[model samples]
Target: MLQVNNIEVIYMNIIQVLRGVSLEVGDGKIIALLGANGAGKTTTLKAISGLLKTEEGEVTDGSIVFDGKRIDRYGPVEIAATGITQVMEGRRVLGHLSVEENLMVFAHNRKDRKEVKGDIEKVFEYFPKIKTLRRQTSGYLSGGEQQMMVIGRGLMARPKLMLLDEPSLGLAPLLVQEIYEIIRRINAEQKMAILLVEQNARAALGIADYGYVMENGRVVLSGAADMLKGNEDVQEFYMGLSVAGSKKSYREFKHYRRKKKWVT
Candidate 1:
């Protein structure tokens, strides 16, 4: 379980990125955060995973609590040790290392060598394709394969909560479907809670139990995934499907007031 409560982040201690952003991820449940590029989705993830500090950003106000422990002040390594790991926007992997080596790199905090080896097998079980390419250089893998490797690498951390950022970016439709199904499976099998940051509204909402929409560093909407999917604002802006069958530009959307309100 994780809670991000009214947290604010400042980059370089000047540009404030998040303003009172709050959300929750319950045990083994998937929660989606959907918005356009500058809505602070990735920053929210970085804040929770303690990656923001790497960019000279810090949670300046409010709290990030994971299983009752305040983790806003912790570093990335400390956060990961607490069973929270993030797979960033890009499918970032060690380009020079073999797939096996890339996966092994994450097990640094893990104490048992034998258990780490067993965990690698578990990752292989989730991604059979990666098992075959274990020795192959990770950079040579295709986009879909690299995405799989990234997710597989996250699993190697044995995380209790997984922060997934734009998992379907640049992948084909079929591959997106496959990866989403795997994500659902991983949730069911590992009982790992997921906080998904995505622009793919249809795909993310399809699998998420709950959802939030952000704009300008704040949460603009929150609801059950089905409720969000059926919402006019979400349909028009995020899903690109409007009941009126017309998309509104950002300018038009700003002037157009929401008929359905959210919890502020």
Candidate 2:
């Protein structure tokens, strides 16, 4: 469980990136944060994961409460040790390390050596392709494969909450579908709580239990994923479509609004 209160983050020279953004993720539920670029989606994730440096971009207000503990002031390593791990936007993997070695790197902080091996096996079981490429260098893997490896490494951290930022970005449609399927499986079967930041609204909402729409660093809407899926504003602004079965097409609607000066 996690609660991000009305937290604010100001970058260098007081550039306010997160404007009192707030949201919640229930235990084992997938909560998707949908927004365009620069809506502070990634900033929210970094703040929660303790990757935001205090001296540069401070948490000017509010709190980040995770599993009954305040973690706003904690560092990234401390956050991981507290059962929170992040799979960032780029899916950063250790380029020189082998697949198994990358998984092993995360286990240094883990106390259970026997369980570590079993846990690595569990990752391999979830990502069977990783097993086949166990000895291969991560730098040589394809983008989708590298994403899987990053996610596998996160799993090795034994996270209570996984913050996945744009997991489907830059991947092919088929690979996106496959990765999403794995994400769904993790949330449903493994009961892993996920905070998903994605521009792929259709797919993210398709798999999410609940959704939040952020605009200009503030949450504009929040509801059950299905409900938000059918919302008119969500469809028009975010999904780039008019209301379902409307006589006026999206282009026609936009033209009319523009003519009337209803849209700038």
Candidate 3:
């Protein structure tokens, strides 16, 4: 449903961030982009969502096409209108507004005013924990609640493609599991396409049909999720596993360098 072809992103006309990065998101499929910090996963999303322009970052080469239309030069509003919604990493919420109000904000652009209420209920169904908190001030909610609220807000837009950046960030392991399950359900039920950017390789690969590994702004590896899960390098580097299936210590893993196969 979406394609990023050899795109290069540059910030302030000088600092290049994404170099020849390319990937595809099939209709209703979960595509995971796995990488650590500064790997340019988020920047790729911004380029596709046109959020890059906000930070003086521009896609200087290649193209981003969604639903067969080129959108590399479009602005954030235009991109959002084209059925793509990016749930940014920080779990940003309207601090002063009620939870329901935050969800309502995204639906304002839709002409289906009456159905907006129904959609709010749909979001509540996905996140029942936030239902009773609808009228409460969003800023007072716990971190997990805020994360649920933000994903629910993205649902309000009724996007065909959702770019999720670090949805599991700063949450407990059980809570992360809950959210990832919800994400999987959202894809299956809504037939929505999701490009999930995550550092939690295990969780992301669990639900993803296909996955890409990024490093230093380039794709180092790409494969089916299960294949990646079984890969020795992926197991060792991302999952902290040794060849013998034992967990490696952080100190041991940190000193290891990734293979230079993609570096030519």
TM-scores, one per candidate: 0.92, 0.92, 0.95
Local accuracy by lDDT, each model = 0.92, 0.87, 0.94
The lDDT leader among the candidates is: 3
* lDDT by residue (tens digit), candidate 3, 72-147: 9999999999999999998998999999999999997999999999999999999999999999999999999999
Candidate 2 residue-wise lDDT, 1-264, digit = tens: 899999998888579998888999999999999988998999999999998874477777899999999999988889888999888899888999999999999888988999999999998888887799999999999999999988889888888899999999899999999999998987787788999999989889999999998878888788999998887777766666665624446444446332211121
lDDT of predicted model 3:
0.94
Off by over 4 Å in 3: 249-264
- RMSD values for the candidates in order, in angstroms, are 3.5, 3.0, 2.1
The best candidate by TM-score is 3
Ranking by TM-score: 3, 1, 2
Per-residue error (Å), model 1, residue 70: 0.5
Question: How high is the lDDT of residue 70 in model 3?
Answer: 98
lDDT value, candidate 1, whole model: 0.92
Q: Residue by residue across 54-111, what tens digits does model 1's lDDT show?
A: 9999899999999999999999989999999999989998999999999998887888
